[model samples]
Target: MAIDQEILEVSSMFRLLMKKASQDWNRGACKMNLTFPQVQILYSLNNRGSLKVSELADALNLTSAAITGLTDKLCSLNYVERERATDDRRVVYVKITKEGIHAIDSVKEIYREMMEKMFNQLSKEDIQHLMRIFAQMLVNIDN
Candidate 1:
């Protein structure tokens, strides 16, 4: 297969778009005291209900100690709590508290507005096309 200028241009544009979108997301995330990992811990807890520290650390690709530190801070702030499993005393689960939920939800509105701004110039069809392209790309990469 031969490369084409159009393909190269589109690929570059896609990379730049992804970069810009990530930057905006980081900016919104920066408003909170949490780093990306800390915020991600909250996201994981919210999504998964509750999980052991090792499990959360594995999901986030961090060491248990690193997650322990983040969880400690979150615990001190009352954003999350450590619980002992009733069935297994040795197992511990971390759950996001109401404060954690509120903190994450508060940033969502602004971040969503940022997403809207990024897509405001595009028509509905364009947005749909972009979604299709992204979905296909995920399939290709994930496999």
Candidate 2:
């Protein structure tokens, strides 16, 4: 194939892979009454303890407004709580509750299962090559 044709094919395959993976993740998350973004928030809080709304937005590559909305839903579900910083009352921090930790654990299981199903056929060498390719692509995109 021509270089242009090869690039187009790779792009198309990338999109398809992302779409299918997203669909599978969404389906699993839905079973737990959560969306992918919500799960991402919980996962972040679980790992990082607590963070400000703006910080969460930056970490998730979402807008502050978007993070607020997601946190609102998570708060309603009692998965997380919003509290004002003691010394800096003006600042609000989002913390994952015990329930949030439980939820994230479940989400992690779903993620693991999905990844296994998707990549189990790949050999270790193939996985390493994929990791390198993805790393290079990210570097290129950042540039």
**Residue runs of model 1 more than 4 Å from their true location after superposition:** 1-3, 86-89
Q: lDDT per prediction? A: 0.87, 0.93
Query: Model 2 — TM-score against the truth?
Result: 0.90
RMSD of candidates 1 onward, in order: 2.8, 1.6
Model 1 residue 114 lDDT?
90
lDDT of 2: 0.93
Q: Which ten residues in a row have the lowest lDDT in candidate 1?
A: 103-112
The 10-residue segment with the lowest total lDDT in model 2 = 28-37
Top lDDT prediction, candidate number: 2
Q: What pairs collide in candidate 1?
A: none
Candidate that would win on TM-score? 2
TM-score of each: 0.79, 0.90
* Candidate 2 residue pairs in backbone clash: none
Model 1: per-residue Cα lDDT over 6-41, one tens digit each: 889889998998899888878887777666678889
How far off is residue 133 in model 2, in Å?
1.8
